[model samples]
Target: MMGESNRTTEIPCEFYSDKYPDPSNHPITIVLFTLLYTFVFLISFAGNMGVIYATIRHRSLQTVQNIFIVNLAISGVILACLSIPLTPVTHIAKQWFFGSLLCRVVGGTQAIGTFIGTFSLCAIAVDRYFRLVIAPGRPLRKVNAMRITMIMWAVSIVVTLPYVYHMNLMKYSPKHGLCGWFCTEKWPSPFSKRAYTIFVLVIQFLIPFSIMTVCYHAIFSFLRKRAKTRLTSIAQQANLLYVLAATAGRETQQHKEQMTHLLDQKKRVVAQKRRVTLILVSMVFIFGITSLPHNFVSTLMEFTDSRDLLTFYKTDYTYIVSLLTHLVGNEPDTTVAPFASLQPLHSFVNRYHSAVIPCANFETVFIWYINEYSGQFSSLAMLSCVTNPLLYAFLNPEFRELVLNGLAGVSWANNFVSKSWHPTQTTVL
Candidate 1:
C-alpha cells in the first residue's frame, strides 16, 4: 500500500489547477473522506466529553478559568465537526451542494468558528496570566468578558454577510475546464470584492492575531516575575519550616517523610505539562502560519481586479497544500539545504563526521520519540489535555469534587457497557 501511494509523487499542479479536486462527486472518495472525518470527530468528541464529564461531576471543577476552557473545547469541537468533512469536498470537486444562500451561511459559520477559536484562546491566556502567573486574587468582570466575546462574534458574523452577497455557485471558468460552485461576481450590487479582501485579512485574522501576540507577551512577563517570587517563597518558607521542625515534638516525624523535597527541585512532576503549554500554543501557531497563504488566495478572488492574484494563487496553492500536509501527517523534507554558512565539508560534518541534518533531523527524531513514547507516557504526557480540567478543580474545590464524582460515575457506566457487551449473541434456530 505504501509503495502504491508513493507512486503519486507529483504535488498539486497549481493552486487554482485541478489537483485533487472535489471528492463529493466521487462515490469512493466521498465515503473515505466522510469516514475519516467521522472518526476524527468521534475521537475529539470522546476526549472533550470526558473533560466535560469530569468537570460536571466534580463540583470543585467549576472555576472561571475552567469555564473559559469549556468554552474553548466547545468551539474547537464545533469547528472539527463542521470543517473536517467540508474541506475535502471543497478541494476535490469545488462543488458546493448548498447554493449561494448556503454558501453565505457557510461563510458565516466559518467566520464564527474562526472568531470563537481565536478569541477563546486569547481569553484562556488572559485568565491563566492573571490566575496562575500573577495570582491576582481579584476576579475580572464576567460582564466585560461576555461583552468582548459577543463583540468578536458579532463582528465575525457581520464580516461573513458580504460572502452571502458575493458567493454564487457557478461552473468554473470555461477556460479552466472545471465545473463546480465558485464564489464569483454574481451579486455585485451590495458587495465589492476589494472590501471583502480587506475585511477578511484585517478583521478576521490580523486583529485577533495581534491581540493573541500581546496576550502571550504579557503572560510571559508575568510568568518570569512570578517564577522568581514563587521560588524565593518556596525556598525561604521551606527553610524556616525545617528549622522550626527540627526542634519540635513527635508530630514533626510524620511531616518529615512527605515534605522533605530537595531545595533545587523546583519542578513538581504532576504539574510538568503546564510547562509544555507553551509548546501547545505553537499548535495554534501552525494553523495560522500554514493557513495564511490560503487566506491570501481567497482574498484575491474576493477583492482587487488583479488576475495576477491567480498567478500568485497557483504559487501559493502548493504552499497551502504543503501546510495542510503537516496536519494530515504527509510531511515533505522541508529542509533540502545545510544549516550554517560553514564549508561544504565543514568540520561538524567532516572531522568527527556524522552527517546529521540540523533542526529538521532533530525534529524528525523528536517526532519519532514522541510517537513511540506517547502511549507508554500517556498518563504523564496526556495530562496536558487535562490541565484545564485540573485547573478547574484547583480553582474551585467544590466544582472539582463534583466533576471528579461525575467522571467516576461516567467511567463506571462505561465499564458496565463493556461488561454487558462481552457476551456475544447466538444465532436464532
Candidate 2:
C-alpha cells in the first residue's frame, strides 16, 4: 500500500502508526467538533441541493449568471456529500480505516471539488463584468456558457491527477508494536510536493481572489457613474414639467401619470443597483474570510523549513525516536534513529528537506495543524457551502420565489405553504 517504493520515512510512520490518540484529551472538544461537523454536512447538503433544484426547475433562473451558480452548487454538493462527512470520521478513527484506493479517490475528489468551486466564483465575476462593462446589451450565448463549464471541469481534473498519484495507503510498525494503514502522500519526488502545494495555493486561491477584486471594483464604479447620470436626467425632467404646468395654469392628468411612472422607474433602478452591490460584496467577503486562513497557513508551512518550526515545537523527531528505542530496550544507532519502525516517515521527511530546498513534511505539519484548528476548517466548509444559496434567497426575489414554489409543489408540504406568492420581476440592466 506504500506506493511502489521501499524508501521508508519514520516521521510520517510515527504520526500514523499509533492507535487513535486523544490528542486534545477533552471530551467537550470532541463533542463540540462532532456536532459542528454534523451540522455543517447536513446544512451544506440541503442548501446546495436547493440551489440546484431551483436552477433546474425555473426557466427564469437559466441566465448566464445562474448557470455559474449551478456549477458552484454542483461543486459544493460534491464536497458536502463526499468530503465533509469524512472530517468527523477521521477525527474519531485517528487512522485511515478506508483502504488505499479510497484514499486516492477521496483526496483527489476533494481537491477537484474545492478547485472547481473557487474557479466558478471567478468565472461568475468575470462573466458579470464582461456583460455589464465590456459588451453591454449582448448576453453570452447558452452554448458558449456550456462550453466554458466543460472546459473548467476538464482543467480541474487534469490539475487534480497528481493528488491521486501521490496519495497512498501508509502502513508501518512502531516500537510500541503498532501497525495499521494510514492515508498520506508518498511523493515520487519530494520536491514536487512543494511545487504542487504552492501551485494550488496560487492558482486556486490567490489568482481567483485577485480576479474577483478587480472585476467587482470595476462593476461598482460603472454602476455608480451610471446611477448618478440617470438621477440627474430625472431631476431635469421634473423641473421642466413643473415649468410647463405653471405656464398652462394647471397640471394635466397625462402629465401626472407620466411623472408617477418616472418616479417608479427611478425607485426600481435604485433597488436593482443595491441588490447587485450586495451580491458582489457578500461573495467577495465570504470567500476571502473562509479561504484565506487555511491557504495562508499552508503557504507558510511550504516556504518555511522544518528546522524553523522544530525549535518552536522543542522536540526533534529524531531525538524522540532514539528515546523511544531506549525505552523499548534497543541499542540506539549513532547515525540514524534506532527505530527501524520509524524508517518510512523519517526517510520521506529527510528526502524532502535534503533533495528540495529545505521545507517541512507538510503532511505531518498539516495534520497537527488540522488537529489544533479543527473547528476552523469545519466552519469554513459550512459557511462556504451555504453562502451561494443564502445570498440568492436574500438578494434575488425571483430565486426566492422559485424556491418557495418548488417547496410548495411537494405534496405533503403544499397545505401549509402557498404556491401563489409572486413578486414583480426585476430585470437586470
Best by TM-score: 2
Model 2: worst 10 consecutive residues (lDDT sum): 330-339
Candidate 1: count the clashes.
Answer: 30
Supply the TM-score for candidate 2: 0.72
Q: What digit string (tens of lDDT, one per residue) describes model 1 on residues 1-429? A: 888786675333222225333222356745765676566556555555655666555555555555566665554455444444454444343335556665555544544554555566667667655654455677656676666667757765665555444334443332323333343223333234344445555754576567666665665555556556767776776777677777684447555653466343355421322543443355345435534533443343233223222124333232233213312421011110111101110010011111122223433322221211111110111112223333322233344334444546566544433332211101000
Instruction: Name the top lDDT candidate.
Output: 2
lDDT of 2 by residue, 1-429 (tens): 585354454433344313334432246655765676577667777878888898887787888888888888888787666555554444343455667677777666666777777788888888878988889878888889888899889988898887566556654445333445455555656467767766776787689999999998898888878887887888888778889999999999978987887797688668767766776677788778666654554455444544333223543333322222212211111112111111111111111212221113444433332222211221243367766667643246567656766867665544444454334222342
Q: What is the C-alpha RMSD of each candidate to the true structure, in Å?
A: 17.2, 10.4
Residue 64 error, candidate 1, Å: 3.5
How many residue pairs clash (N, CA or C atoms closer than 3 angstroms) in each of the candidate models, in the order given? 30, 15
